[model samples]
Target: MKMAPKGNDVIVSDRKLEMILSMKGGNGEASYANNSQAQAIHAQSMLHLLRETLDNIQLMEPPSETIPFALADLGCSCGNNTLYIVDVIIKHISKRYEASGYEPPEFSAFFSDLPSNDFNTLFQLLPPIGSSMEECLASDTHRSYFAAGVPGSFYRRLFPTRSIDFFHSAFSLHWLSQVPESALDKRSMAYNKGKVYIHGANEHTANAYKKQFQTDLAAFLGARSKEMKRCGSMFLVCLGRTSADPTDQGGPGILFGTHFQDAWNDLVQEGLITGEKRDSFNIPVYASSLQEFKEVVEANGSFVINKLEVFKGGSPLVVKQPDDAAEVGQALANSCRSVAGVLVDAHIGDQLSEELFKRVERRGSCYAKELIEQLQFFHIVASLSFA
Candidate 1:
C-alpha cells in the first residue's frame, strides 16, 4: 500500500484488500462453510424480525406477481446460512402476500460478496440432497424463486436504481473496504506499532479505526439507498459495542486477535518472521456502537430506522460437561478462523497463518473456561427503509 494524497489525507487503493479479504472457502473443517455457526446462531435468533419487516413493510406499490420481489443479501459469504435466511425471507414474504389476498410474487434472491467467495459451493448447495442439480434449478416455472450470485464490494453500487426490494446482511459490515493506510504507515501518528488491532491501542490509533468505519458505513448506506426501492425494507446485523469506552476489551470485550499477536511475537522472538511483518499487520474490522450506527444513518439522510435492538452474543458452544474444554476450544477456533483467519493469512503467509491458528486452538483449549464464560459480543440488529 502506498500513501497517495487524497486532498491531504494519505490513502491507498483497495485492490489488495478486496483480493485478500475473504472467509476460508469450501466445506473443510476450518472453512467458513462449516465454521459459520456463530453467524447462523445470531441470525436465526432474529428470524422473527424478518417476519416483522414483512408484516409492517409498506411498499410504494406492491410488486405484481409477474414482477419478482428482488432481495439481495449483501456481504453474503459462502455457507448454508445464506440460503437458510433467504429461504425464510421468501417463505415469509409469500405468506404475507397470500394473507393479504394478493397473489404470491415470484422472488429473485441475490447472494453478494467479493469475487473470491466460494460461489460454486454456495450454488451447489442450492439443490437438495436427493434432487439433481439440473432438475431443481433448471426452470423458474417449477419454483417460486430464482437464485443468483453478485460478486463485488458492497461499498460501491452493484444494482440498478430502485431495483432491490429488500436488503439483508449479517456479521459482515464490520469489515472496512480497506485497512486505513495510516495504520500501516510507520511515520503516521495512527500507526499501530506493537498491536495487530485497535482494541487496546492509543487514542490516535483507535480514532483512525473509528474514522474508517464511519467512512465505510456511510458508503454502504449511500450505495444501498440508490439501489433499494422507495419503501423497501432492509434488515442488517453487525458486530457492535455497548461500552462507553472505545478501547474496551475487558472480559473478552475483544480477545480473538490477541492469539495472533502473541504467536506472532513468539515467531519474531524465535527469528521466524520479522517484527516488521507483525507490526505492519492490522485487522480491517470494527464493532461500532449503536449510537455510532444511528448517527451514520441519520447523517446519510436516506434511510429511517424502524426497529433497533441489541443482542448479547450467546455462546454457540454446547459443552455437556466441564471436561469438554477441547470441544469448546475447537468451536472458538473455528469461529475465529471463519470470520478473521483471512486477516492473518493476508499479513503473514498461509504457512505462518496455519501455525498461528494452531497455537490459538491450543491456547483456547487450555483457557476454555475463560473463553466460554467471559467471551461476549454485542450485536446490533436493525430494520430500516427509505423515509
Candidate 2:
C-alpha cells in the first residue's frame, strides 16, 4: 500500500481539482461532470428559493452598479461545477430582469478554496463559460469577471468588505485539517483511537468538534459580515454526522469507520500491510449534530438562516451507477487519473494504486447494491442572507 507522506500529504492540486476540467484524450465532460446531476438540482432549488425569498422585498426603481449583486461558491472543488451553478443563477437573474424591465446588476463571482488548489486548471475552464455567457447576456451588456482561486480558509478571508451577494458551498467544510490539538490533549486512547466510540468516545469527540466548529463558525461569520452587503444570500451544501451516537453502525456522517474498516481489511488481505494501527490514521473532521449546525449558524450575526434540508440515505444529489458497472468504473478511473498522479507523487507505489482503485470499485459497488438504503447523507445545505 502507498504511504501518505508525513504532515499534510494532501495538497489541493494533488486532489484532482486542477485537471478535473481537462485531460487530453479523455471524455472531457464526463470526467468533470460527476456532480452535474446534483448541482443542477441544487442550482434550480436555490434560485427558486432565492426568488421566492426576494418576492416580498421591493428594490428601488433604478438599478445601480454601486449595489452590485454577487454570489460565491466557496470550497468550489471544480471550476466546472462553479460554471454550471453560475449559468443557472445568471439565467434566472436575466429572466427576472426581462420580466421586470430592470437591467441586471453586474455580477462578481468568487471561487474559493484552499491555497493548494489548481488555479491553472480552474482558469483554463473559465474562458469558455465566460464567452458563452457573455454571448447569451449580450442584450443586457452585463460584465462577468471570473476570479481564480481566492486562497485561504473559508472560515476566514475569501473576500473583501461588503462584496458578496450570494454564497454557496458544496460537499465541503466537514473535513477540518486535524483535531484541535489542545482540545484532544486530555482525551484517552480508546476515545482518540477512532473506534466505535459508544459513550465516552462519542461525547468527547463531539464536544471537541463543536468547540472548533464554533471558533470556525465565528471566524466565517466575522469575515462575511465585512464582505457581504446587507440582505445578500448564501447557501452552504456540506456533510454532517447523521447520528449523535456512534454505536449504530449506520450512524450517518461520512462513515469514516466504514471507509477505514474496508481500507484496512483490503490492505491486510493483500498481504501488503498488517495491524490495527491503521485506525490511528483517522482524519478528525467535525461532523456535528444538526442542532449544533443550527447553533453555529444562529451564533454568526451577519447571516440569517432561510432554509435547511437534510438529504438522508440518498437524495436527488446522489450519483447513481449505470447499469454496467464496468462503464461506471471506467468513468471513475478517468475522473481519478490525476488522483493517481498525486498518489505516485506522494510515494504511494503503483501496485498499491491499482489495489486501492479495486477497493474503491468494490465499495462503490456495495453502496450501489444497497441503493434502496444507506447511500450516505449530505448533512445540510443552509440558505442564508445578510442580516
Per-candidate Cα lDDT values, in order, are 0.76, 0.52
lDDT score, candidate 1: 0.76
Q: What tens digits encode model 2's per-residue C-alpha lDDT throughout 156-242? A: 767777666666676566645444554334355234443422223455555655676667767776777788667566666655556
Residue 341 deviation, candidate 2, in Å? 10
Error of 2 at 370 (Å): 2.4
Candidate 2 ranges with C-alpha deviation above 4 Å: 1-47, 50-63, 127-134, 138-146, 180-191, 194-201, 241-255, 268-277, 284-286, 311-354, 363-368
Off by over 4 Å in 1: 1-14, 59-63, 128-143, 249-253, 316-322
User: lDDT by residue for model 1 over 100-195, one digit each (tens)?
Assistant: 777666678899999988899888778433232233234322334678899999999999999998999988888888778888899999888988
Candidates' TM-scores? 0.89, 0.72
Q: Cα miss at 129, model 2 (Å)?
A: 7.0
User: What lDDT does model 2 reach?
Assistant: 0.52
